[model samples]
Target: MTENKNNRTITWIVGGILILLLAGVSVLLISEKKVNKELTQEFELEKEDLENQYTTFARQYDELKLTVSNDSLSSLLEQEQLKTQRLLEELRTVKSSNAREIRRLRNELATLRKVMISYINQIDSLNRLTAQQKEIIADVTQKYNAASATINNLSQEKKALNQKVTLAAQLDATAIEVTPLNKRNKRTKRTKNIVQLKIDFVISKNITAQTGEKTLYVRITKPDNDVLTKNDADVFAYENRNLRYSIKKYIEYTGEEQPVTVYWDVEEFLYAGTYRIDIFTDGNLIGSQNFSLN
Candidate 1:
């Protein structure tokens, strides 16, 4: 009996130790499951944060590209944006619990930020250079405009001076006289007795006038206001157009007062009224006179 009781006690002690071991193992398993759940939640939060960071970086790169005007710089920005986009896609696809991939993405984010800072610096430098160029161009344009205005003013002044000189060099006529003559070359007052009309004038002395052989034109108008010309082709240049002239004569000018006479033969019937005569030289109407035949 003593032997059986000792055996029973030893068996009971072993069973109790087994039960305790099982309880301890159960508690350990529960604790391990809780820890794993907490770790998974933390990994999810980290992955979400990393993804948000990549998304924000991509937005920043997009904005930077829009602000860039240089082709090379814009291209670099585009490439960086694409890189960020690709990383964002990778982060989306990666498992939430993947610590290695998340760590890699974090490192890439830091690198991209540094690159963005460099791009910003370059862009600012280019903007400053462009502003300086604009200022230089504006200054040059202003100077050109001022020079053009000065040249224009000088040209106008020269034209005015030349006009004054031209006017001063023009010749003048004085003492104009007209007479009616008969066939015997005697001065006549009767319309039927007149056979010709004569005009006489004196060219006043002008030191500024040129000494040369000059052509003079004469126009005679009857009392009926009809001009007498040899034909429709009897024309001379006045201003910019051809004007009818009754006769033309050439004379030598010596810059001294000189007498001139021009005659016109009358083939048409003469009337007992006043007749007008105009004399022109060098595109100017130098003298005018009137005569009457009763």
Candidate 2:
């Protein structure tokens, strides 16, 4: 009977030890499960943060493309943007438990960020250079305009001075006289008794006048305002037009006061009225006179 009691005690101890061991195993399993849950939460948070960074990086690349002007640089930015998008898609597809892939994408994101910063700095430098070039062009244009204006003003002044010099160099005629003469060279007053007309003038002394040969033209108009010319083709230029003259004479000018005389034979019928005489030289009317005969 005692032996039977000892065997029951041993059986109880073995049963208690098994019960405690099972309880310890249950506790260990619960703790391990809690730890696994916490680790999973951490991985999910990390993946979400990485996704946010990748998405933001892609958006920033698009923004950078807009600020770039160089065609090659813009194309490069577009390529980088596509790469960022591809990486973002990969990240989205990756399981939260994939720590290795998540870490790799995070490294790529860092590299992309550094590249974006470099592009931004380059774009800024290019913009500054463009601004400086514009300023220089504006300055040069302004100076060119000023120079053109000055040249125009100087040309106008030169033209005006040349015109004044031309005017000062022209000859002046004075003391003009016209007389009706008979066939005997005596002055007459009656229109029927006159057979010739005498014209006389004096060129005033001018140091500026050209000293050379000159041609003189005399035009006589009757009371009818008809010019008397021996030939219709006896013409001279005046004010860009041809004018018929009654008499032409040639003389040598010496830049000193000189007297000149020209005669016209009265071949046409004379009338009883006023007559006018004009003398021209060098395309300019130098003297004029009026007379009357009965």
Candidate 3:
């Protein structure tokens, strides 16, 4: 009986040990599963945080790109940089257990790298374009300066040419000769009643004249230093203004010098003395001469 009792006690002890081993294994399995679950939850949280951060960074980069200068290509480059950040985040988030997802992330990362390279190339191209634009602007400015200088030179030359033409067309004052029919010398004395005074003048052959109606004006000085001219109401056209003349005559003077004859009857008293006569035509005092009457 004691042997049977000892065998039963040994069986019971072995069974209890097995039960304890099973319980320990169950507890261990549960603990391990709980730890694994916690690790999975932590990893998911980390991945989600990375995704959120990457998304936020991408948005910030986009907004920053929008604020870039209008003339720069930095916007595209920044976009690629943001894309690279997002792809890196995705690459880190995808687990090894999800092979397809990891592969997708790898592909995305490769695409992002290509896009970044493209942006780099674009930057190089933009730099080249900027240099080219600078050169073009410089060329245009130089051309404009040259053109302005040429125009200024042309204007100066034109002004000089105009001055020369005007000088060539000018009329001289000493080219007129006059004569009184009965005037012999400066000391000749004349009666108070003079019948008429016949005046004659000659124009210089070098006088530049146009073929137009030229009105000649005459001003005669009497013996008493009196200017013998008609009143302002008897104004006549001569030298581009209203003039007073004792007599009016029209002449068609060609370019060649010609003689002009004018006759004036003295209605007023003519004291005998030296008399000066002025002839004008075409905005110039063409000639002047003196004579005496007896």
Candidate 4:
């Protein structure tokens, strides 16, 4: 009877061990399933974040196109933009459980970022160079304008100096006298008795004037303001037009005061009124005088 009891006790112990092992296996399986679910959730979140990054990179390429003016650079940016969009589409279609594909796409995102940074640096360099060129052009233009203004000022100064020199070199006449003579060559105040008129003048000394031969014109006017000339064509230049003169004399000037005399024979009828005499040289009126006759 004792032997039988020992065998039964052994069987009961074996059965308890088997039941404990099955319960431990069931707990292990449940824990493993929970861990797997958490891992899958983490992978999905990572994939969503990666997709967002790719979308943002694509949008950035569009913005970069707006900043570039070069046609070749714009074309390159367009290619990059399209590439980023294609990668984004591929990322969206990929299963979250595909870790290999997700990792590869992530590496591609890094490479795209590096390429975009390089392009940005290139664009910045080009912009800085263009700004420098504009500054140089503006500086050159300002200097040219300053030089032109200086030249104009110099030209005006030279013209003014020339005008001053011309004025300083002009000849002047002074000490003028006129005497009416009768048929006996004697001074007379009677207009009807006058047969000739004598004119005398002195040229003033001027060292600046040219020392050479010069022509002098003398005009005599009657009481009626009529110029006395031998012929209508007896003319000399005064200002810009020709004027009738009673007498023309040639003299050699030595830049010294010199006395001159001229005469006119009265051929027309005379009246009792004031008469005038004028002398000119080098197109300038040099002297004038008026006298009364009876």
Q: Which candidate wins on lDDT? A: 4
Model 2, residue pairs in steric clash: none
- Give the per-residue lDDT digits (tens) of candidate 4, residues 35-56: 9899899999999999999999
Better of 2 and 3 by lDDT: 2
When summed lDDT is taken over every stretch of 10 residues in candidate 2, the lowest stretch is 164-173
lDDT of 2 by residue, 1-294 (tens): 999999999999999999999999999999999999999999999999998988888888878888778999999889989999999999999999988998898899899889988988988998899889899999999999999999999999999988888777778778988888999999998888889988888988878888999999989998999999999999999999999999999989999999999899998889899888888899888888887878
What lDDT is reached at residue 194 by model 3? 48
Q: Which stretches of candidate 1 lie over 4 Å from their true place?
A: 1-39, 183-188, 223-226, 272-276, 284-294
The TM-score, computed over Cα atoms with residue i paired to residue i, of candidate 4 is 0.64
On residues 1-294, what C-alpha lDDT tens digit does candidate 1 reach at each position? 999999999999999999999999999999999999999999999989988888998888888887778999999999999999999999899998888988998898899989989999998898898889899999999999999999999999999988888888787778888888999999988878878888888989988989999999999988999889889899999989998999899999999999999898988887788888888898988888787778
Number of clashes recorded per candidate? 0, 0, 0, 0
Error of 4 at 280 (Å): 3.9
lDDT per residue (tens digit) for residues 56-127 in model 3: 545655654554454446656565666667586665757734646754655665565566556556656766
* Model 4 poorest ten-residue lDDT run: 164-173
**Model 3: how large is the Cα RMSD against the reference?**
7.5
Ranking by lDDT: 4, 2, 1, 3
TM per prediction:
0.78, 0.76, 0.51, 0.64
Clashes of 2: 0
- Root-mean-square deviation of every model: 3.6, 3.8, 7.5, 5.4
Instruction: Tell me the lDDT of candidate 4.
Output: 0.91
True lDDT of residue 57, candidate 1: 86
Query: How far out, in Å, is residue 216 in model 3?
Result: 6.1
